[model samples]
Target chain A: MGNCYTFKIKNNFPELELLCAEINEIARESNFSEQLLFSLNVCLEEMLTNIIKYGYDDNRPHDIEIRLEIDNEIMILTIIDDGHAFNPLEADAPDMKSDLQHRQLGGIGIFLTCKMADKLSYERKDNKNFLKILLAPHVAAL
Target chain B: MKLTQLESTDRITNLLLSGSLDISGVKDVEMDFARLASGKRAVVVDFSGVTFIASLGMRMLLSAAKKLDSEGGRLILHSVPPLVETALETAGLTMVLPVVKDAPDAISLSQLQR
Candidate 1:
């Protein structure tokens, strides 16, 4: 890995702002493409929002760890959360063809991330959910 | 996020939004957006100033649009960036919250509903 950035945030929405700021700073320092930066933001928001919103059973504080690696021509993102076991790769696809009245709000975040990312994988290790995303040179922006 | 009503009347409502429509940003303007967009008038939003959007943002827009449709009103978005437009299309929202080229087009489209 060329440069690795790691962060740990409490599982809350307010805590996400700080991490997003750090990612913005990293994007500035590395001069990453706008598409990639947008994708990165989307990935973090979607994945972590799921963990923070629906990852736990009891009302207790939790910590989520995020790691971003800027290798030569690819960007690697790894998120670790001590929430319940859930695989994003198996998420139901959002209803993209539905009309406004019948549209479903669920799964749009993960669906957008999947459309933007080049590759994505999920694993449960040590009672934590590990979701890794790889974005190559192409972000598949339309 | 910042949401400003450029103009508002019984016939139409025009608003300008500038900021990332993330979780916090959504919280910042969702109430005002809903209030303005829920009225019995065509709502036009200028999206050129908006730099980023995601699912939360999409939900906000769709909710307003759905409310408008139920009330016989409509919401239109104009001057969107390509990337932001991509996200909207990905969510298939351009149909209900139609995207136009500029303020004039958005205003015209909104008025067309009347």
Candidate 2:
């Protein structure tokens, strides 16, 4: 059974390094798939960036705590933020087929997060929004 | 971590990006793309040089593309290097964003009367 690990980061962008690095080290040590590690990091970045940009409405910065656990072949990532209650999963889905010139730039984070993860869910628990993403075991390319 | 202008035409802009597009490079790329979005209706981001893109990099593209879209502009991607393409494809960005064969094609397509 792989153990879970937790780390805290300020809403600032650079603080994301700590979380990514930690996740990378753990994944390497645990022999997680490379694709799994990369996807997890990307998913984390998408969620954390949203929290940093919109969670507090660009006001005073706050903190985000990230937790990761692996069971069997699945990897789970949980992100919690104490800032203003906002849910990335609730953001309106993008009109993906729209012409490039007509598309909007925002919401790509949530879009990519949901797309990359095998399983994704969110909820506001005790006034904190917990965003979770799961990655399935890597499958060889066909 | 590395970005070099691959080609620039009146209709499209292609950039060869390499290394990791993560927290370290997001801000700079955002600022760079912000400037590129100015006065341009279509942009093509060539990922031929890129190997990996994290959430931070994806956010940069999303936000930048949104800005361009709001202005009645667009961003297309081309020649996504295999390593980086995995990330984008898995993210379903390949389906959402317009992708082309190479820089010239992207530019030509961007210039098409739409």
Candidate 3:
């Protein structure tokens, strides 16, 4: 079994970068590719930004916990935050082919996260939102 | 994010953007574009100061630029740093948008009908 790491951070955007940077370092230590690291960063940013924006009411601070587990060349990221129960997958997706004049921009973050991650799941348990994302190593070229 | 603008003689609006382009700053970019859209002028977004861009930020800029493009208006970008330029190019946006070297060059090139 691979080792697991946990981190707790305030629900702030700048602080989110620190979390992402840590993930990147772990990916490096685990020998994951650069592409996988970037994908993780992107997914984490999307999920965290959602919580920081809509999870808390007014200026109340919240705790966001991130867990990293390695399993058979896969990196699993589990993010838990005590914010409002909002499902990011439920958000509407933008039509990428739509003309600029008619295009809407708010929903692309979730869309990108969904596309980039190999596996993604979300749960709202005990008044907390848990989002899990997994990234697998790139298949070696033939 | 910090956004500063310069208006050229040919009525091209050059906006210099810096800092992280993420969900937190997307709203400000949208509002700024909406304010600029009210007028009939070309727009150029300078990415010299930008270091990182998220999907939301890219969508915001693309949506705004498309709006301007539809009304016989022009929108160009310039001075994109290496990392951002690589991402934009890889995403195939470089082909769709004209990018110049500097703010002055973007304004000068804006004169050429696209």
Candidate 4:
């Protein structure tokens, strides 16, 4: 048995603030560690920001659905969007060895999200982009 | 987000940032932060109060740092929460923007001959 929460947000940036606020509350109530909270926020912010920034082709607004589930010791975050079939897993990893002057911040969002979240998988089906991220605690809580 | 700056010396500028540097937080302070960092002095940011950061925050910091770098100045962050520091490190930002233990360590590093 587990708990699941769903959120529907517009394909815009401002909506994320409300979404994160509610998420932070539930995550704290569920005993998510501070580290876990940070990681969750990073993943949400980065992924959704990417989708909002580059996911659409037309000027009209769109809808993005987010599902957060807590199953025992694991946290699963699933984002479903109706944007183009872009797979974040295949996005180019940014150059981590470059000097400051040579560095470009383009690809770091998804790359850092991948590093923070324990597991990530992406798929395109039924004309929707499904991106799932799994987060496990670094240490079992007492 | 809240940004506070200390009385700066001729060689050092100290700023303390509090709250999440997420989307809205970045919007709340990016302009002020950029203006404060646009100096030739070493800019040391106290990051102990920041509870969250994402790539947008990173971009804000990077733009300011890049601008400061072009002007021969630098940005240093200290007292970062562990996981936040890890996120920065994962993106290889801590190299260009050094994260030290405390304000003193950051200050000392800023004093070192470049």
Candidate 5:
């Protein structure tokens, strides 16, 4: 059986620190290498930041759920949010060739998250956005 | 996260940053970072103590680099940990933001640009 951990936070941006701390603790206990931990941290922060920043249109508070299941060398991360129905996989990739003068800032978050993870899938159900990410051991080796 | 501003010369401004540069870490230093980068000839950020970095942190650096570039200044990063360097490389930011080996190298690189 795999180990499972879940974290729930408000839509507020400040809550990201808490989420990161929890993940860090779990990753350490699981003996994750620094590189793997960094990738996982980046993926979590990027996805959660996107949801918190652009997922909602109102000021009302909402809950975001993150679940992690670790089995052997594979990790499955599931993030569920009650915000807008947005599929990150469908977002346009950033122009990597742009020079410093023309380079865009914000779009790189989702791109980096996608590149670091092994598999990414998105689904919208009952007005909630579900994002599933898989990180295999081989991807972490990079 | 802690941000310490080193001595500023006529051509280069040094900022030593230590800690996680995630969302909160970026927030703690974004304003100060911007304030220091503004109108400066060159900026060297010593990343020896930075343990982690994320997209938010990368965005902060990129924004600062773009701002410096537009103002005829440059931003250089040195002493970056392997993990942080990999993250920057993965995002292809190393092409724009120059990452060097040490503080002296960063200073020299910035000076050469001027």
Candidate 6:
């Protein structure tokens, strides 16, 4: 058993900065390494940004929920948004091999989130999108 | 976020960037970065001060790199911290943009492409 933390923010782009600051404080208190911290930050920012940008069709405010739980050496992150039915796992991976001339920028965020997290799962229930991510400390090569 | 434009000479413009290159950070310097990078033969960005980077920031750099590439110029980055460097590498940006050890090396790499 470990500690769990939950944070809620409005579906606004500017709110991301505040959320990131809170996460940073928590990461420091938990003694998270810089690499792990950076990975978590990237994953959260990409997911929330997508929700705020394209989740809603109406111009109304909404609440996005983020929950973090740390058990043993692994961390679990859950994000819940009352947005449209979009599954990130199904998103196409960016063509990383493509040169600059042909590369597309739109898909890199989701691609990065998929690549950085050790495990990712997505579900939609009652018009809410749920995304779960698991991260583990990197073990150096022997 | 802070962006300092070093004095340009020898056809290579140097820009020192520090702080998180997230959405707000990118908003703070994208226009200025564009202005400084425009029409330059080569640009060397010092990434030692950059603490974190997101996809939006990557887009900004990629857009600038592509612009420079189209103009027959090059963009070189150096002194990146390991975490940020990993993010760039994961995105496969090291293929398009050259990452070196230091500013001098970055400048020399950009110069050689000319």
Best by lDDT: 4
lDDT of 5 by residue, B31-104 (tens): 99998986758888999999988778888998999999888998899999998898898888998889999987
Candidate with better DockQ, 2 vs 5? 5
Candidate 1 interface RMS: 1.1
- For model 5, what is the error of residue A66's alpha carbon versus the real structure, in angstroms, after optimal superposition? 1.2
Per-model C-alpha RMSD: 2.3, 4.8, 5.5, 2.3, 2.3, 2.6
True contacts kept of each: 0.69, 0.43, 0.29, 0.83, 0.71, 0.71
TM-score list, all predictions = 0.94, 0.71, 0.65, 0.95, 0.91, 0.93
Q: In candidate 5, which residue pairs clash?
A: none
- Local error of candidate 2 at residue B83 (angstroms): 6.0
Over A108-134, each residue of candidate 6 has an lDDT whose tens digit, in order, gives 899889888888899999889999988
Please, what are the lDDT tens digits per residue for candidate 2 over residues B1-114? Answer: 666665576656666666667777665466766777555568777677665686557657766777776777787888886657776665556665677888778878887875
A29-130, model 2: which lDDT tens digit per residue?
Answer: 877766676677778777887777777866776778888887767788888888777767678875556554454445656777776788778888888888
Please report, as a residue range, the 10-residue window in candidate 6 chain A with the lowest summed lDDT: A133-142
Tell me the docking grade of candidate 4: high
Docking class of 5: medium
Using TM-score, rank the candidates from best to worst: 4, 1, 6, 5, 2, 3
Runs with alpha carbons beyond 4 Å of true place in candidate 6: A138-142
lDDT of 3 by residue, B1-114 (tens): 778866544576767788767555565566876666434567878788886666666766676677677777767788887756755554445555677788778777877766
* Separate DockQ for every predicted complex: 0.76, 0.35, 0.27, 0.82, 0.74, 0.77
Residue A98 C-alpha lDDT in model 6? 80
Give the per-residue Cα lDDT of candidate 2 at A61. 63
Tens digit per residue, CA lDDT, model 5, A4-114:
988899987768778888888888888766766777887899999888889998999999999999877778889999998899999987767788878776678888888
Is 2 or 4 the stronger prediction by DockQ?
4
Residues B53-75, candidate 4, lDDT per residue (tens digit)?
Answer: 88899999988888888988899
Best candidate according to DockQ: 4
Candidate 1: the clashing residue pairs are none
Please give the lDDT score at residue B19 for candidate 5.
95
Instruction: Please give the distance, in angstroms, between residue B82's alpha carbon in candidate 1 and its true position after superposition.
Output: 0.4
- C-alpha positional error of residue B17 in candidate 5 after TM-score superposition, expressed in Å: 1.2
